[model samples]
Target: MSVLPLVFTSGWASGINAYAVVLLLGVFGATGLSDDVPEVLQRPDVLIAAAVLFLCEAVADKIPYVDSVWDSVHTVIRPIAGAVVAALLAGQSGSLPELAAGAVGGTTALMSHFVKAGTRMAVNTSPEPFSNIAVSTAEDLGVAAIIIFALFHPVAAAVIAGTLLALGLAAVVFLAQRIRRFWRRRAQRRAERRPTGPGVRHPVPTDGSEHF
Candidate 1:
């Protein structure tokens, strides 16, 4: 079976939540649930590490500003993970070069990562935490579900993943201006709230132009 679909799906998932994708692939591969998953990923140590990181991400992803920080930190991690997973999948077939697969994975992951990070940054502008929790949960569930589905129906899963990636990218582009404006407004609010120095005082107009 061509590993192209799995490669795309894994790349997309990794961008959103690399640890969750790793954990799912490891668990499924270890249990004989997925033939496409690579053996290295199914190692007990790998699974354990992925599970721990997934847990940490789950917690950090539900907090507003913290999630953005987490995303920023993972900017490098996620793309690397995507490339590794793609290379592993390609290795299973021995038909595609690891380099080619890694390039595909890295490019896809970078695109999706940008969309994810931008969306989260925009979301963080909101004061409420519920949206963050909801979005985080949705991403986790989406990664888990897509990886599982790809095990049985790689083409279908890949199509869905592609569609999602396109939509997400479109959304990020459409909202770019709004996101920028949101940050500008936030900065303005912060400036307004900042306390002035104790000695600072407004000068009185002696010309008697009415002080509003």
Candidate 2:
């Protein structure tokens, strides 16, 4: 059904940018663009709140370590948001059961969230700053496009979102080994750089003046 496709699409986008998806949906409903969206999402206060959070995410998502922390914090939030949104849509549409929609939305959101978080971990392994910004920018754009397009063509939007989700998951799996190695090397480097306390001792120095 159209409701199912819309929920699946939104669920995928929610994993990457839940606030953005919520804000956009609220705006669409408030503007009378889509009757399928629930009034609860279109309230003035809800739109304001979603917009504020979306702005916060837009900024925090561009920084490397900050983005990872953001992702970690949203691991639970995103999936719940997806489920609530799906349930509301289903309740309004009367095409699908609320519980079924919630399950589909929440499960898809969880899977896509892991894919996103894992991909970020792998990307952060790179020393460059631009990659994080680029990835975050792309995700925001993708979420907005999918949500807007889903308003008119839910099934097509779902197909695109599903494809992207699958690609992201595959990329995460492929980079799992690299992600592990990067963390291990980083830990070793930190230990090597750690300051020696008054009671600590070291092996032969690297300086020629202090030979083995």
- Error (Å) of candidate 1 at residue 132 is 0.5
Relative to the true structure, how large is the alpha-carbon lDDT of every model?
0.89, 0.90
TM-score of 1: 0.87
Runs off by more than 4 Å, candidate 2: 185-196, 199-212
Cα lDDT tens digits, model 1, 1-212, are 68888898999999999999889999988998777778999999999999999999999999987887798899999999999999999998786788899888877888899899889878877889999999999999998999899989989999999999999999999889867976787689788987788887756788989658
- Residues 1-212 of candidate 2 have per-residue lDDT tens digits of 55999999989988888899899999999999887789999999999999999999989888877787898899999999999999998999999999999999998999999998888888888889899999999889989999999999999999999999999888988999867865786588789898888977767666677844
Which 10 successive residues of model 1 have the least lDDT summed? 177-186
